[model samples]
Target: MKSISSADKLEDQKFNALRLRQLTETNPSIRAEFGESGDNVAMLIDAISRADALSKSQHIWYIDMIEKRYDDLAENEIDDIDTSDKDLKRLHDDLRENLIATITSVSIHSDNIKKSIAETPDAVQLLVNAMHYRGREELRTTAVVAIRTLCSLDSNKILFAKAEKIFKYLTRMFDFRDGLVLKAAFGTILSLWSFLDDTESNSVFTIEPSVKAHVIKGIIKLIEARCFLDDVLEFLARLSIHDDATEKMVMYDATTCLFYVLRKNPSLHTKENCAVILHAICCKKDHRTLIEMRSEEKSRRTLSRLVEGGTPRAIIKVNGILERLKE
Candidate 1:
């Protein structure tokens, strides 16, 4: 018997065709047999190698058949089968090379396949490793996007905790003057926030005070660059709703950052622009006194805009501030 080593040879096109046929066969025994044993490292390498050939020729038909078969199994089983066996791990490691290749392949045109590869449990780490392995800027960008998509699928606890190195790489992208990289960085932050919200597991995977401050600093740099101030301001305003004091402090820093932006270019902090910040500060009654203590011209303008707008919360805030001002 051939040893199932990590360096197993990839299967040929003919073998892939046979495997596809076996995988799609309607016979229950054959389907089970393929499901149990066909998904090994060597086979996956083979499948990836032949993906283009099969896809262009007969791969699409086989994929359709396999999808239908899996759908049927899912409907009946109602539980995800455990594919975390040792063999699967080895296969995932082997498939990492193929995934990176496809990501860099100029000819590959299937977003679904990319997404499927990203959905794998270990895929984010694999992509991160590929980022280090390939020094090409385009490949690094692709890896970051792929990792972000994968992390978006789960909580920040699992994704951020396990993928710190990738997070660092992503943060560095913000330093580049490229708009696309900046956009990707924004997406990665949003994904991290989404993960925090969805999991509710507060062990500080990525939204910790330090990380939050780092992100706020990056947004400030972007504002200084005069790149995307309004969007950044809105994001900060939205983030203020979180209950964490550290997060709230980051929001305060964001507010201060915006104030500097407004001082330099007052037009950006229009009445409409400051409403969300006003709402955020006034969410807690005590915060109104704090807002009044700032005593900056823009803060007063923001408070006045809130008052004129007649938002009940804003009205209360103005009342509190006015009483304090009177004293």
Candidate 2:
């Protein structure tokens, strides 16, 4: 094994020099010469695997090199170039697989590599499947992170489709009583929300209403848990902007949640937060039903706060809602 390690080390040194030449040579002929061989791809993967097996330090270096190489490739105008080359595809697949495998092996410390792995559409689904295959909490969490990072970086339709699978998994996990799972679930929801557009929010092809309802329920449960109130608030704020009937439903629950939170602990419900909720409530025409559900005196008091004593910002938000209400 030591001799194999030394041989691998010498081979890797030569491979690194060739790889650098491939990256730096701008001449098409030179690039073609350096990039032509099936052996180059095989050697790169072999070097990565040997590094993984031998020394942790060398493994990190090889992974870092692979990441930088990919970043360089992405920065190229090569999107127009025919990377349909079989050798290139083989190299891509090999690198992606080893990257994902390495990431899953040491989930926490490999977040950067996980992020790089996610750059490939195929790799995103692979990680999503690995999450199910491993079922280790840390691995699942890492997979969620990878999915989110990919969603952030790439608007590729296939990546978004992969994200749907991750979203469903996380939504289910959110119901767990475990705090860490709940946190990961919240992060996943935010990522899913980030990818949604007006059309998708309303489109039959996107997340179903039932799933949206379950997401709302999960959010409400999280709010009740009092674990991530700020995140809950931000998520609600974003969902309120979603263009669908579900947004209205979310606003209704949010209004009720805010009311419950305020009524339960009157002192904490600063005039400012109360005013914001009041304004949010009035923003929706449907919210009148919710407001009417409140006792008359409470409703009148909320109205007064909105119309009179709340902050200027709150007054403005409420006034807008009132105008919408009149129509």
TM-score of 1: 0.49
Top candidate on TM-score is 1
lDDT of 2: 0.49
- Native-to-model Cα distance after best TM-score fit, residue 253 in candidate 2, in Å: 3.7
lDDT of 1 by residue, 43-95 (tens): 44344433323223343444565667666675534333333223333343333
Global lDDT of each model? Answer: 0.49, 0.49
| lDDT, candidate 2, 106-168, per-residue tens | 222233333434443345555565345322355455455545544444343335554445555
Separately for all candidates shown, the number of backbone clashes (residues 3 or more apart, or on different chains) is 1, 0
